[model samples]
Target: MTQAAMPQVLIVDDDRAMRASLVALLEAAGWRVEAVSRASRVAETLVTFAADVILSDVRMPGMSGLDLLATLQEAFNPPVVLISAHGDIPMAVKAIQDGAYSFVEKPCEPRRLLTILRHAADQHRMRRDTASLRRRLTQISGLDRMLLGQTPGIADLREQVLDVADSDAAVLLVGETGTGKERVARALHDLGRNPAGPFLALNCATLQPAVFEAEFFGVEGGQVGKLLAAEGGTLFLDEIGACPLPVQSKLLRVIEDKQVTPLGATRPVPLSFRVVSATNEDPDAAQSDGRLRPDFLFRVNTFVLALPTLRQRRADLALLMTHFLEEFASVYETVVPELTQDDMAALLAHDWPGNVRELRNVAERRILSARRGGGSVAAAMHKDHELDDVPDTLREAVAAFERELIGKAIRAHAGRMDAVAEALGIGRRTLNEKIVKLGLDKGALL
Candidate 1:
């Protein structure tokens, strides 16, 4: 492995000699090590070093190792092994209960310590990946108010996605069409333990049962199926509710056995992959209608995430409007049109029955028409309908749009100040100053 790829460890001890000794032990094992003589800087160290495993002495000045563990848990909690003395067994037990990965006794055995460190390092890698994906989810969807907004529903969904991304559990994402269910599945895959592994996605609705056996289970001629293609990664089955009952049985068997039997072949091929499925319809209704098997449903959605429709998350429409405006304008090489107060009200009040996809199309149309100097977006949106009494001035409307625009840019880039600043065409210092002045929340990224 390259030097950068090597596992990085952080050692915390007040005693210089002990700290140096621990650092040598880890470095000798081909691991990169950073040793500190204080627990107060543990948080700073984790961020700066991006350490894979933290080996800290339980007895320390200021905050104890246990206290550091608690503090870190509130943030990006790593796998911490408290190096406790012989008499600190009770304290070690309490530390483990409080969410420390494991504890090692002092006068540590080199072999035992290395074993613990390796395990901790592996877990640390998993958490690191999931955490990165969690951040990217915000960044990629930053302008996407429904998924990356400050609304309670979006906040709840973000938490659920982060919580389940690292696990091997089967996930079922349920939502209306255009609600970005596939995006959630991809996040789970990207944030999974084996992110480097191949991610294979298939639409169950497009599966033709007659040839699906070959498509899913592979042919006897040595063609690999979707199941095998996703080995060591994730297989996302979208619109799973549309799958035929016969296919559902086979899917259940594959999931249960964690193996696949290719067509015209008897012996099964053992495989390792995570399953994340999604549907636009209600799962219970599908089950009742015999479109989905109860056993299959139970096996697939061990962790279910229900996505809200665009109408439910209407608070983000204006932001999404502005975002899509920038999006299509750049695509078609047209200028982004301004949204008057009447336009904003009409867009917000109109229930987007078609959800995000419909809104996107609407934005594209608006941008195209405005490019040809045809008409305003508001006129087109409210062509057949009556306009609401929107009393806000042009300045107020511009300020509101700008706020959401900045907030979305902040979130979409995972709160990386440099990237956010670059995207906004501003300097880092100016962005920080603006955030303070505008009262924008930067905590979500951190």
Candidate 2:
């Protein structure tokens, strides 16, 4: 069945007549409707009914509809159209600012109210379908455990991970902060045959010098360190460059001997696990500076995987954006709104110094803020001049403009690549190539 025919609306009003009327009107209009009398039970009812739009009375006994709206705003972001008997323009304005979909008076025009509800419901369904499709695609793609990316740099890294996963050799992953180094390590562990064994991880930077030895080698009280905890699996040491020289020496000894000497213990414990370490610093420079031992570096550098920065793999930006959009939409219970060409342009023009993590934050903010304002995010972004500024060079300017326009079109059409291409008066293959050349994903723009 088509999405519009499947939308569900929740009617929250104390008056039985109003609730019945809303249910009848919505059902007759080809929408699924559920009627409820109490605001206190809205949350439970929402979960049970899986509402797409919430039509609620502003003032009610026990808990006011405004109170219910505020409470449900966080858990469920369905568009709420408020109805009030005693209209207060200021209160309605405040409600819109606080994320209400729209506000209407009690002596409401049936046609106008129904039209507004239909638009809101349609938008909600679109967002819900987008999110649902993303989740299903992620599962079907079978890349949930492996960080998904199609860039050449990421592909190379994945190949290296697979190669190293087959051996018992130690590996060192190097990358900037928030580059998913730990995720790479986990992927390595999973790819190996011994995945059933414990995969233990600890951040060396967070551990104090005094506890470093005890943490890595265990203690007299029979407490096992991360190394021992991974027995036959993998031990991941995050931020290994931050380890003190003294602690480094002890770790080096364990790597070489395949045994750890626990603190306050006379005997050494035999370890059979593999070691995988990650650092954001340059290992060669650190070794030359006496911060890291050259021998230790060689021991752990049996294999090395260096992750590229976000800008270096700009081709994956759109894919990452879509991934984050789906994630945030599910978490916030909001519809995934379409992006404008200008919004896409801004995203492409901005230098993402913080990488994927930063992009996720921006997408989340845009989605939530747009819903609260009762407007399309793309419309708001179009007003920003930064999206229109052309660069100095013709090639650079054209590329920048194309990226922005394409990005915006995809967003505007809710990531429908065909629709975006048609809107921009371009062929599908040409649009696909442009997206690739611009370092974006067609799906992401959608």
Q: Point to the candidate with the largest lDDT.
A: 1
Score every model by TM-score. Answer: 0.52, 0.53
**Which tens-of-lDDT digit does each residue in 1-446 have in candidate 2?**
57546878889899999888878888888888888898888888877687888999988999987888778766336889898888698989988988889999978888898899987877776556545546655674433436667688888887788777888889999998878898888888888769898898978767676877777787889777767788899988888888777777777888889898888999988988888999998998888888888887888888889988888887676567667766677887877656543455666776666676667667776666544433443443333435456578999988986887777778778887788778777899999889889998766555
Best by TM-score: 2
The per-model lDDT (C-alpha) reads 0.79, 0.78
lDDT per residue (tens digit) for residues 200-267 in model 1: 88888888878777887897777877678888999899999998888888888999999988988888
Q: How far off is residue 393 in model 1, in Å? A: 46
lDDT assessment of candidate 1: 0.79
- Which portions of model 1 miss their true places by more than 4 Å? 1-146, 379-446
